[model samples]
Target: MRRLAAGVLSLAVAGILLAGCSPAPASDDSPLSAASPAPSRSTVSAGDPDLPAMPPTPAPSAVVDDAAADDAGERLRALVGDAGRPAEVALLGDSFAAGEGAGSYQPVRGVADSLCHRSADALLADAAGTPPSPPGTAILHNLACSRARMSSVTAAQAVEGHGPEGVPAQLEQLAGIRPDLVLLSIGGNDLGFAGLLQACVVDTEPCGQDPALRETTRQQLLQLQAPLTDVYRTLGAATPAPVLVLPYPRLFDAGAEDCGRLSSTELAFGLEITDALNSTIERSVQAANLPNVRYVNALEDSFAGRGACSPDPLVNTARFGPLLNAATSVPASQEVLHPTQEGYRVLTRDLLRWLEENPM
Candidate 1:
C-alpha cells in the first residue's frame, strides 16, 4: 500500500468510497475492502505483487494540456443525446465494480487467461436503459476486470492477453477512447479484505475482534489517500468527461444480529469496514476537488433491507449447500458475496438517477 501511494502524477483511479457516517459497533472492529479475490478456473490468478513505494504524485494537470479542458466540456455537451454522436462510457475496477456475481458474462477472449468476468448484463452495459440502444446516443466500454487495483488504473497492466500485444493501460484507454463518463470501483483487494473474509469463512470464531488484523487493515486503507487522489487527478487529466464513482452497497446488514454463519461481531466488522472504505473514497475525491468527478458519495443506504442475509438479499451470499453437497446441481458458486442481477438493476437505476440530478 505504501508503494501504491508513493507514486504521484494524477488524482484518483479505479476508485472506491462513498458518503455516510454509520458508526462502528465496537472499538475493536476495523474497516474491510470491496474486492473479491477468488478467480474462476479459466481466469488468471487475481493477485498483483506489491510495487516498491514510489514518490508522491504531482498535480494532475501538470501532465495534461490546459487547452483540452474546454474542448472536453464541449465534446461532452455535443455528444450527449445527439442523434448522430454516440456517448461512450468507460468502466474500471474489480469484481464488485465489474459485472461479477450478476447477469451473464461476456465471452473471454481467445485461449489466454483473464480474470475479467466482465458482464454483458452489467449495470452500465446499457447506458440508455433497455436496449435497441439510442442510435448514436450512449455506449459502454467496460474495461473493468476482477481484482484490479489502484495501480491497474495508474499504470499499464498485462492481464487482458487477447491479441499479441494485449490490452492497453486502462487510464490510457480512457484517453484514447475519450468516453463521456467513467465509472470506477476499487480498493478492497489492495486492503487484503479477501484474507479477512477468508478468516471469517474458514473459522467459526469471530475474525472481527482481532485487533492486529483490524489495525493493519485500517492503516493500509489510510495509505490509499495519496494514490487515490493521484488517480482521480490522472483520470481528470486524461479527459474532460465526467467520472462517476459508486460504492459497494453493504453486504451484510449492520443492524442485523447475524448473517447465516456470520455472528454479530463479524457482521459489525463488515459494516464498519465498508463505511470506512466509502468515507475514505469520498474524502479523497473531495481532496482532489476535480470538477468532472461526480460521486453521489454516501455510505450506501438505499439497499437497507436487501443485504446478503436479509429476506431479500440483493448481494449474493455463501451457498453452503452447494459447497457441502455431493450431488446437488446448484450451478456454479463464483458469485458469492457479490451483487445479484436485482442488485445490479437497482444500482443502475441509482446511477442514472444521480446522472439525472447532476447533468453535464
Candidate 2:
C-alpha cells in the first residue's frame, strides 16, 4: 500500500511538470512587448477557494530527517554548556518561501495547510555548506504558499483567512504562534511573474527588447513602494522578531554563451527584472528603517554563473526535466523558473554564511 501510494504520488506530482506551468495570460496579448502596461495580478484575497482539495503527497524527504537526527545527537553531546533555547522561526511569502519549486510536496502530519507546497529542502531546515549552529536548531512554521502575494501574506484582511481550509494570512498565522524570527520573500507575483513568463517563454516576439514594456514594469514595481513600506512597518510592529527580507535571485546569468531555449534578449531581460526586484526590496527595507527588518542579498553572488542559460543552472527551465528525480517523476510545474533542490542548497549555504557573519 505504501509503495502504491508513492507511485500515485509520483504521477500526480509529475502532473505539474508534464502539463506545463503557464499562468493565465494577462489582458494584453503581448505581455512584455505590449504597447500598454499589464494590469496588476489577483492574489489569494478573501477565502480564495478556487483550487480543489490537494493531491496526496509522499512521505517527507529523508535527507532533512537524517540531518536533523544527527544534529540532535550533536546537541546532546554538547549539552554541557550554552544550551540556548530554540528559536521559533516563521517563514512567509510566495512559492519561493514555500519551497514549492524544490519539487514534491512533503506531507507534514497534522499540518493540512502545509499542502501549500512545502518542501523538505527549504533553506532553514538544513545548512548546505558550513554548519551554522546545528540542524533542528529552530522550530519552523512555514506558512508560505504557491501563488501568494502581498495581500495574501499581510494582516490587511478583516476576515480570518484568505485561502482554502481557512489558512490565515502568513502574518496572522505567525501572530498566533509568536515566532522569534521571520523570513520573507514576496513582490514577484505583484509584478506579474506569470505574465512575464508567458511573454518570455510562450511568445515568439523579442518581448525583452521592448523599452515601453520594461518601463511599464518598472512603473508597476515602483507603485509598490508605499504599500511595501507599510507592510514592513506592520511586520515590525507585529513582532519583536528579526525580519530578514530575502530578494529573489536572477533567473539567468545573461552573459553565458549558451542560453538553452531562451534567447539572449530574453536572458538579458530576466537579468533586468531581477535587478529591479532586488533594488525595490532593498529600498523598501531601508525605508521601513525598523531595526528588526533587514534585507539579505541572498543569491546575487551564489546564483551568478548558474542561471537557466548556464550549463549548470540552479533554476529550472520550462519542461526541461527534473534535476534530481528524473526517473521517479518529472518536476512540478510550479518548479518552473523556481530553484531546484540544489539551488535551494546553494541558498541555504549563503544564508548560513550571512548568519555566521552577522549573528543576531
Candidate 3:
C-alpha cells in the first residue's frame, strides 16, 4: 500500500515537471523587468505567523541519540583517516548552510521570536556530529542564518524579530575561537536569489526575458566582488584556519525544458545568474590571493543531469505549488533554489573528498 502511494506521488511530481516545460505565453511587461531596483534583502516579515517555528535551543541535558552519534563519529574517523584528533570546524553563511529548506531548524538561544533558521540537519551539523571531538573542544560553531548577506558578516546587524536590538556581527562569533577549518556558503542572498525566483515564477509575466532587468541584476551581482574579496581577506587574517567558500550550485540543467514553476526562460536566466555569481566569487578569491582561502567548486558537475527539471534534483522543487499559491505562506519552505537534505549530502560527499585530497 505504501509503495502504491509513493508511486502515485512520483507520478504527480513528474506530471508537474512535464507541464512546466510547455512554452509560456509572453506578456508585454514583467514585474521583474520594472525599472525600479530590486530590494537589497528579503522582504518576508520575520514575525510572520506562517513561518515555520524553530525548536527552542536544546539544553545540554537534551542529549543526542547515542547510536547516531556513534555513526557520525565513524564517518568522521573515516574521512580524517588516522588523524586521531578531529579538526575543529565552524560553519558560516546563509540559508544553505543553515539548512533552511532541508527541514528542522534549531531554535535561537534565549530569543523566542528569533528565526535565524539554524538546523541540526544542516551539512555542517552532520559533519560536526560525524567527528568525535576531544573532551572540552567545540567541534562546530554554526552561525549561518536565514537571509544572511555579506553585510551580515561585516556589520553588526540585527535579525528581524530575533531581538529588540541588533545582534552582533556574524564574524564576531569567530572572534576568540580559532577552528581548523571554516566552511562558508554565502552571497546568494546578496544577489537577491529569493526575490529573483519570486519575480520570475509568481509574476504573470516572465521577468527573466527582460534585457534591462537582467543587466541591472548582473551589475548588482558584479558589484559584490569587492565585498566578497574583503570577507575572504578578513577571515584569512583573523584566523589561521583555512576558509572554504562554497559557491551556489547551478539549480537547472542547461537545455532542460523546465522544472515545476520555473519556465525554460527562467531556467536559462537563473543559470546565467548562478554562473555569474560563482564566477564573481572565484574572481574575488583569486584577487585576494590569500593562502588560507580557497574556493570549492562543489557545484560544477555535481548536480549535472539532476537539476530541478531532472527526475532527481538536488534542489527543492517540491515546494513550487505551495510557493505559487497565495494561500500557503509556509515559512522557510519558500527556500526556493536551496538544496535538499540529499543535495547537502552530495555536497558533503564532495567536500569530504576535497578535504581528503587537500590535507592541511
Candidate 4:
C-alpha cells in the first residue's frame, strides 16, 4: 500500500512507517486521521469488532494444502533466524503496509510495537499476536511514503537503493544482507490509475461508459506491465527468498448508489475502472512469471462482489458510522485507495496460509 500521509502528516506518522527502514519525508499535507494516522500495537485489537471476519481460515480452503503449509512454515523458520529467533524481513511497498488509519503501535509479529510503517509487521503481529524481538530479531523496514511511486523505492535513503530509481543500488544492498524474504506491494502508482479513474468520474459521462475512457484505462494498464516486469526481474535476481507482490485491493464502494449523493452513473464508472484494473493485474502477472515472484490475488478475494460500489455491499453504504458514504468514506486511507486494517487482516490471514503452503 502507498503511504497515506504527505507533508506534516507524514512527519508525525513517519515514526510509524514500518520498522527498520526510514526515508526522508515528502512534502505533502499532513495525513488526515482518516489515514489511521499512526498505529501502534494496542490499536490492532482496539479496532471495530463489527468489521467482517477475514475469509475462513486457510486450513479448510481447497486452494491450499499440507505441502504449501509446510513450505510456508519453512520459510518463516528461515526468516526468523537460528532457533526461530526473530530475524530480518524487509517490507517494501506504499502506505498500504503502514496500517494507516489503524492508530499507533502498529503491531507485527517478531517486531516491537511502536510507529513503524510496515504492513508485514502488522500482518506478522496480527497473525502471531505479538511483535517479534531480538535473538528474536526485528529488522522490519517500511520505505513507503504517501506520494511514493514505484520510483520512490529506488530513491530514499531508508529504501534509497530499493526505490524505483535505486533498483541497482537495492540489488547491491540485498546481495550483502541476502534477506530471508521481501514483501512487494507496488504498481498502483505506475499507472496513476486511481487519479485517472477519479478524473473520469468528475469530468465525463459516468453512465455512457465512453470508449475513450475505457481505452485510457486499458492503455495505462498496458504501460504498467513493463515497469512491473522490471521490478520483478530486479527482485528475482537480487533476493533468494520468495518475493510476494500483494495485489491491489478492489476499488469502488459498490453500494455507493445507496448514498443518493453518488449517482448510479458514478457508481457504474467506479466499478468499470475497478474491473479494468484487476484485469490488467491478472494478465500482467500471468505474462511476467518472474522466478521467485508470486502475485497474491488479495483484491479478487476481498472486494469481489462485496466491493465498494459493488453490485451488493456487505454493509449499507448509505448509513453513517462504519459504513457511511461508500462513495467517500471507504477509501481505506485518504487519497490512497487500499484496504482498511479490516482489509489488511484479510491479507494477513492469506499470507499466513500462503506462507504455510510455501515455506522456504
Rank all candidate structures by their TM-score, best first, as comma-separated numbers.
3, 1, 2, 4
User: Which candidate do you rate higher for lDDT, 3 or 4?
Assistant: 3
lDDT of 3 by residue, 299-332 (tens): 4445656676777777766344533441233343
| Ranking of candidates on lDDT, top first | 3, 2, 1, 4
Summarize candidate 1's per-residue lDDT along 50-117 as a digit string, tens digits.
Answer: 31221211111111133432233234435354545666777887676667777576644453334466
TM-scores, all models, native as reference: 0.70, 0.70, 0.73, 0.58
10 residues in a row with least lDDT, candidate 4 = 29-38
Candidate models: Cα lDDT each = 0.55, 0.57, 0.59, 0.43
For residue 23, what is the lDDT in candidate 2? 39
What's the distance in Å from true for residue 100, model 4? 3.3
Q: Least accurate stretch of 10 residues (summed lDDT) in model 2?
A: 39-48
Candidate 1's TM-score reads 0.70
Clashing residue pairs, backbone N/CA/C < 3 A, model 3: 72-130
